[model samples]
Target: MTYAPMAVMQPTAHNRAAETPLPPHAQITYMERTSSELPVTEFFRIERPSFDPATGQARFFYRLNDLSFTETLQLPMGADAAMAVSPAFAKLLGLTGLVLGVSYFKLRAPFAIEAPEIALTDAERAFVIDVYENGLGEFYARNDLARFGKLSLVAPTDPVARQPALDLPDRTLLPIGGGKDSLVSVDLLTHTGVDFTPFAVNPKGPILTSVAAIGTAPLYVTRTLDPDMIRLGKEPGYYNGHVPSTAINSMIAALCALLYGYSQIVLSNERSASEGNVVFDGRETNHQYSKSLGFELLIADTLANATGGALKYFSLLRPYSEARIASLFTQSTKFDAVFSSCNRNFRLTGNDGPLWCGECPKCHFVFLIFAPFMKKERLLAIFGKNLLDEPKNEHSFRELAGLTGQKPWECVGEILEAAACFYTLTRHADWHEDAVVRAVKADLFAQYGEEKLQLAMAECLTDSRDHHIPPALAAKVAAYAV
Candidate 1:
């Protein structure tokens, strides 16, 4: 199903104030909740967002009732003169402001989102609606917002002219997560001789160190969140949980592509990211929804249309599963010491955290998935512990292998993909006796027979027909992933 992103949200006379520095707005004061315990937020509004071609600074404003919030980013780039003159920049900025609204909108989560300031086409309206509804699926499920009313987006606008496809530089900008998956892409792209630059919005220890091992200069951007937003999360009556972070990052990448003259925004999201974690109120929510193939296609098409194919977006590792990616990751040793997939280590505002926090689902899953593919000593040394041998981690493995409970609310593979790894471990002499392996063996086999497990393992090792990889890069992906 191709979603047509027609000339969207044509800006009107409102452009002058939007392009200029923001005028003073009301402060998003605390305690908007009424005495009845129900929030009084009836609507969420996207105020005009601004960008300065001189400094590459951008600001986004949003409001919930009388309260207003701001978010800003200082990009390490000068805005493109040509792109600034074109309609692409404004449209991209507007769309970006619309998507970034999720961060603040999730705070109050009112039923209505009104963008009367910017006029949007029907297609733009649909895109924004999806950004709020499906993009916030995990937030809704986690907060158990079933009793809350359905969400609506109102973007009354006249259609504007679409930008013709501009000729962007022939280069790839890869977002490094300081994980095994992105490192695999770095190795594969390097070996295949692709001209790409490692990019990150905010560099953390792991991401910086891992990129340093690649021995190349990486482009880094600085994004600053409103301190009030963080402070409010600690305040009473405020809602906080996961948001569609990848969606926000994707928009940022597109902006960088425009300003920095990069043509391709390469991601390393695997095939298994498409799976959702749970179903609530007849709605399925995926922790990795923004990283999934569906979101990939949507954003890819949106960029292709918005930038007129001047900028392209696709996950280079989309055809492979987490287990397969792990197998490929073991083939590279350059980032073994510095790479970390632990969620705790990738916090937005922290440093010097442990490379691996052994207790989390990310740690357990990464260790377990890699156990079947790597040597015991090497894999264990990287994580600084043998997660499978620990008795307490058995329950984490249990949920990952689908023996009990729902799929974890983390960036993990499908249940069968995890079960395949566990079953392969059960057959391995090195890992068969591990506490987690032994504990899950009976229930794992009972739920998925030996033959089925073997089939799942084989399937994960094979390629998927579903992906948005360009034809030129297809063989490289197959060679590296398989």
Candidate 2:
């Protein structure tokens, strides 16, 4: 692949050679460009060693250079495992460069960082700068900080927080997803008397149906993936793995918020988003780092600064856990039939396939968590099968129960929630005869025992209360026995 050359160099070298080396398997090369131009930066190359089958070890390196900085990431991999990153992820990195350019303009910083010879159009640069400044302004105000420390250069003074008794208009932007989270959010916001406008992108059948069931004013955005980009994947050499969905979704959410003219953009993101990613070296990195409080705050700050305090962005369900959100939906019969947490149906290319690929981690975790609260038959109807009945799902259930492996990095709450439900179900006489439940009891349940399980449940509940579960939901949960 072709790449632009470096623009200029102001080298300030600092060494930390004592730091522990990263694993051999994964490497990431990050290049930031504040240049006012399209295609301002490029990721030139990535290299990974062939794994040794006998010894089970591999190494990888990533390199990138722009006028300002040349950096490399080195990683080692085990024979049985590999580190994967998608080309979509590289696009996000590109977008991040654009965002940084916007940020630099807003901050009016002395240094102009750009890819060598690449320049942005004046209009595009202004738009990015405006958005970043608007976002940062609100962030400082909301946090009650006296001044923008490092962020001051990019953000204007926040006027919104200066007003002591500001009346925020009761306008809501409905976050649409092909999952249960949005369904629950729609229900809660509707019942709470907020005037809402439903917004969706890349429409699909199940999501459209769910939105219709909510009976709200719906707005749809059409999105078409660039055909040339898709064609690139068909070539003999293409990189694909996982792009941080949070980054893409945040951009989409911001765009939607702008078009809809809504003050508050309500997202259905849950507490589990704060859970760290499982690193290749058995260490944990926050997988939802993009979805976590840090990203949310940064985006919100950037919008406030860029817009001059005109917009507000936040996850309304940020304080709620997946389990608590599930419980909230369970209480509302209106959503019982409409909601779905299955990931299979949400994919862009897999509609003709099974709606619930029951073997996936998400399906197994969701089914297990909801089992104790919803009636057996009713829950099965929602998922189209008794997921706990299958031996394959049973294995997944054990994995989630913290039996065979570390918790899956997607969401921390899944493991804790499943553990609580498994604890509750094993003690109940009615659920005792279920094959998966029995298997759970024999294989993993017996090891934890009742006291340990109950303690684990209490810890989960306490942790949820401390971080994830919203106050209103916490009150409701306090009244309900697990």
Candidate 3:
């Protein structure tokens, strides 16, 4: 279906104050509740949700063995109008549980299943193994690679079942992450006049404001983690690190699309996500694998067969590099203040803290990416400080530029792209004077050289052919390509 371009709407005026302060590190407790003996899955089921329109709660319940997880999607409006409470919608919710169940199971590193599809087919088994092994690559590398390597899947005892695709609406469901990339997608999707809903998981603070800035009321869901997991992390043998959250959110978005009748589920992942930070256990370990084209294709195929060819899922910005994405983000100046790419802002526990923790690799890289597109004053205003001006942040920037260590396992661009950004900064008179930039100037020139730096910059500006975007969606995003 073709969507026409619509003029952008004015944002609703509101007081934008900083949230109550919380310790940046204090918020997230890496909670992994693993047993020496894997937690046996008695059965997995999604109960019928209890929706209270008056109070505005859409609660989803899931039970995996003895553990129970409840996810409440706090809607902006009443749930009564979202859709009728039907079995079809209930099944979609169930499927969402099935997808999220994988992550939950990984927490304990379960070994056996008791019921409700006790085993999976070779294909089904392979899909689960891929998502788990690759998605949980970071977790495995950090915690216990020996134990994680020993993990295995239980093959299906019966044939795999596929659900017929439900008849759904033509509108698209766009997952918003309150970052520059998603904002760039918002601009493109808006310009195309696509019937799209900006949706978010655990939306608060910046995300809500960003949706408002686009003049659209967001469809948001709050995800609450099991408190027990946090307590378990404190225990001595429990493993804890990062989970492939993008994979979890993608499934949730797909469920919402099916439940609400949207035909397409859109994301903002870029080409740079495909690059691996390091290799672990003879496998390429990428922190952003779930957001990569490979995972996109895997999930797309898996969901198509599972859902009987219903919804379409793809990243709108997959073809572009992070450098190209930053370039596109500059076209829309409204999000400069509200959107934040810092991972520190959205922790799993407690209230969120500052948007930018200037000490982290994310802070250093985003600063470098924006330096080429935005002026010095504008960039400083967004980040609250000049990252390059701080000698303290030099180590982090060095990691990003490949001047010293491997790419810090953060959702940063490729090393060469970081080099390209640094090279671009050298050409910018205001940026070259920064303390960190001045320090790294010689090393960058020696490693990448002037000629190679320009080539990397050119490569970054060009789009990649690797993507799973549908033809129509490709045509829409193509207009913004640098």
Candidate 4:
């Protein structure tokens, strides 16, 4: 029934605003409760941060139920021409602050099923569904698939004041994740002469190396989760799992677009992300749910509502398949040495020793995707070793090729797409002799027959029209599509 004061992490020159009290953490407990007994008094708030130009830092705070969290973002000194920022942009940042809280809120899910959706409008509620239900669909299905179907969310009934539109510039804000798809996006934007600034959260070795490969500086934004969430995850009652990271990152990009006066926010998600890994309780659980077209539309519509249709957010590579993205990435050998899709290498602090661990699903899939596009020697040189050439990779490729087992719970292309890539390579002189490829090809041909392999290859070459790419950018993106 009480409130926890927002914790400020950094000292800044900007003055603090009055703190509005909200529900405390003790108000919600998980012990011995049925679905109907779930607490409804839970509240989440995004407190306005004070930005100190002297330190070039902005300190923001948020609360979920009773747990308080603080995140600080330090801007580069003298990056912009003006020191003054508009209030509308501050509100946009607050919206992003709310998103920051929601991402961490997943650590408390199922236990605290009810959120302050009453704080959101009808459109905002729909956006929240995409962010929570769909975005966290993988998290729920992984932890408790059965109970997930019974969960329902409530929306805010209170009216919100709409703000006037901002006079945004033509520049685009592109978010980079130190991968082939983002690097390909950078190439497309540069080729079209579109003004853009590469944006990232918690810049590390792989991200820095990838951005440096293209010869440009990036606008780095940092997000720090409360250490208590990690501690709480170890507790008996608190739930923990993956959150819709791309959804969270998109919100960060949206705020950056507003703060830097950019009208467009560009992402690098591919069309293959739309497919689900498995269906459970009448819902599809996709690891890349946040990157799907549905989430993209929700984000676009939500941003329009929040910012008066002045800001735009969508993926530049949404039309291209993973195979097509791999082909386009092969166009520029400049990034081959630095680009990595291995999720293992990416961390909050630093990349693991090797860029390619060559063990995980991502490493195996990246190897398969690049096999048909780049030469065997060049691909091996980039990965430090040929993944498909390794005899130990047969099982991994089996999952990728769908010759055996379910698709691994990783951000990979669908089973048929992987099969298509592997099948296509069997006909190519460069890859047919590799050990893993030979094993996968032999197994797939034996199980599904040669005709199915042929069909899989044909499907890989086709592009999906299910995207929200703007009319102006569609021509430019299509030029690079395979």
Candidate 5:
């Protein structure tokens, strides 16, 4: 019932208003913080968010261990932005703030982030618990913390995600990550003549060039994190690891669909996301858990409950494996020069550096997946070097090829896809002698025989039925299947 004050004027915070005047909705009284030791805080409190519909900016506040931080999301708004705001819209905005609280919550790794400031129904509260538990699965495992997980955060709850009925447009909102997977989605949707808009948050670099290559402007959203939080993470005793970034983006995309009048938010998550990296603390920790189908279903159900069924979110690429998507990516060269799957380009702190670092697991996997379907020369040209020829990359490739340790905690693909690609490459005279390939070929072949490898690859290229894609859209997509 009471609101938390904003924290933009703190000495450590950057003055965002100097760049633009504070819209009346963004204007809030500033408060100073304690100048002493970090408090032994027990709760990661989610505060009431402040928003200005005129500009579509929402500032979310959170307090962790007595330290306050503010994060902002600038949604798409203008004359085309929805003017008729309702209680449902505000509720969705509140939920956005709630999910975003995970950013600061992980710092102290609090026992509870109950978020008394945000008005969530009992069902909504349970949804937040699942997000913190499963979404932070990797975080807990990496930090050696056992506080929050399956047995940790589950409260006895009932299922009650009410779908709200509203007259939303027939168009879709495609979230392009400027990768082969998303660009593949963009090409397929265009091939089938589906009306859609490209959307991204904090888009720059390849996200810009890749969409520019497609010759369409994406609905851009800017996300600003508090400088203090970044500064604190560098200081001693701050917990840091991965958070479910896609889950955070999904919330923003839903807001875009509502404000921009789109009915569906299409994602590029693949079937491989469902596979976990390793099982620790009796939990199967997945690197792409947020992108998995289970999380997609959770968001869909939560959006229905949050908006009363006004919006829909699902992955357009869910039915296909990473190899199938990679094969489809090679079908067109429209984004070949610009599209990159390298995680090096998207790091939070450092890499605004290379198009493809050509060494990380992401680069290795992308190169591996595309080799069977793309020309060796063309694939090498795209990456500026053959990742397979680099002997230093062999160990990591072994992990991806399912010949070594558990999948290197990255958003690469299912182990079989990597093995299948390696198996397919062994027969190619042009590629068979590459250093990494030669090193893994013997081990990879013995692990999966030729017949089994071929069958697995055939299945990778073929689409599966486990998806939520509409029958009509599925038919249209099938008509243009590569």
Candidate 6:
């Protein structure tokens, strides 16, 4: 459960020295039965290494055991591609990359789960692989092997057979963030006649404002991680880096569900959560590690084993795309002016900051998707500027059109939906004059062609319905398109 600091061994001409290693830790454990009642159990042992001067990387490895399946993950220090590692890691310890690749590889039998491909350049791939290999070794050294021994006894049991359902008050805990996804989730849950309280952790003004507008009871938690640990990171030390806020937030939701007797912890993550991060070491790891299906199943299994009852953690928005969710929000009276999916606005910084810095991929994608549903004038009122007018946004639009770059890291649907929305808007007279639309016409359709582009767009639109857009909202979507 604890790790000692490894002395920095300087790499010779061949072996590079790794940075200070953090205490060994277990990321998670799960014991569950498949729908077919096949018993499955797994645990992750994370060994994080000290920073390495040679590569200028922070590394960590995770060893996973699932009774039958074993996986070893080696993650290198810097983030490759656009998904930057957390700013906390950078500010505290000079961690680079906005997102880090958390690779998972089968160590035992080759488990055949289909994952998305890693999209990275050759140099980025080399850096990612190096970090991954070094990180894996550190995880092995730091983790406690003995704790895993207890997990063997835990097995998944049928929820209905184990205990009678609790007949407590019909209370629901609606998870709310400032994003459009969660707002859509809250609306759907409210429509379902569930009496609920809105839950948030360390939320800023924009999110709080949206939640307050919902008029639900608010439950908030003030998170305080050890500042000493953070300060230690500042002193040329090592850290696992900023785990996705969603991962930490999910853990908090699990605890809250357990303590408050809530039956379900509904997440707002979409199906695109499965899209892998940019590749390192010939593997496509999850950038939003905890949001992915693998992590969701792990957390659900853990909660079930601990409580021995029906406690659920599922994405209410799982089947939908960012576009469909935005479409639903635009059609809804509750969310039209208030909902925000922009990451920059969601930061601890105040709302007075740019509501939508149209440059980021998120802004570009959001603008693209919403353009089809809302007229130009109304859309500009909401976003404050015509995002489609910017030339940088035009390139991002073409990227979504499959003209440049691979799918972005945030969500695969972001790109897919943007492409679809672009195709849809081009068919309309209103959006034809829009400069970005014109660029997509000249740049994208010329290459991909209109027929192929339309087919792809239609496919994406069809795929959006399989997700958790409630019947009322789905109806609204249909009505809007009509």
Report the error of model 6 at residue 317, Å.
1.4
- Scored by CA lDDT, what does every candidate get? 0.78, 0.48, 0.68, 0.69, 0.75, 0.48
lDDT string for model 6 (1-482, tens) is 22233222111111122342211221222232122321233333333323333343333333345322212112223332222232212221211121122223212111122111222223323332333332232232222111111122111222331222322233556678776778877776666555667887777765777887888767665543333333444454123332355644654554444434466677888655554323322233344555655456655544443344455666676655555566676766665566666777765335576566667777777777777777678788778888877766766666554556544444434333455677788788777777878776766566546775676555444434334333654565344442
The parts of candidate 6 lying over 4 Å away from their true place are 1-170, 229-242, 348-351, 411-414, 463-482
- Tell me which residue pairs clash in candidate 4: 25-66, 117-155, 117-156, 118-156
- Tens digits of per-residue lDDT for model 2 on 84-186? 2222222222333444232222222222233332232333334334333333332222222222222211222223321122123446676687577777777
> Which clashing pairs does model 3 show?
119-156, 120-155, 120-156
lDDT of 2: 0.48
Best TM-score among the predictions, by candidate number? 1
Tens-place lDDT digits, model 4, residues 313-375: 888887777887888888878887787888876754565578888899999998888888898
Question: For model 3, how does the per-residue alpha-carbon lDDT over 56-113 read when each residue is reduced to its tens digit?
Answer: 5556665656667776655444343444354344444544544555545555554442
Candidate 1 residue pairs in backbone clash: 119-157
Model 3 / residue 123 / CA error / Å: 3.7
**TM-score against native, each model:** 0.90, 0.62, 0.82, 0.84, 0.87, 0.61
RMSD of model 1 against the true structure: 10.6
Give the Cα-based TM-score of candidate 2 against the true structure.
Answer: 0.62
Model 5 lDDT per residue over 55-102, tens place: 678899988766999998887666233423656566777788878877
The alpha-carbon lDDT assigned to residue 131 of candidate 5 equals: 78
| Top-lDDT candidate index | 1
Query: What's the residue-level lDDT of 259 in candidate 5?
Result: 71
Deviation of model 6 at 46, angstroms: 9.9
TM-score of 3: 0.82
Angstrom error at residue 319, model 6: 2.1
Q: Order the candidate numbers by lDDT, best to worst.
A: 1, 5, 4, 3, 6, 2
Model 4: lDDT equals 0.69
The 10 consecutive residues of candidate 1 with the worst lDDT sum are 8-17
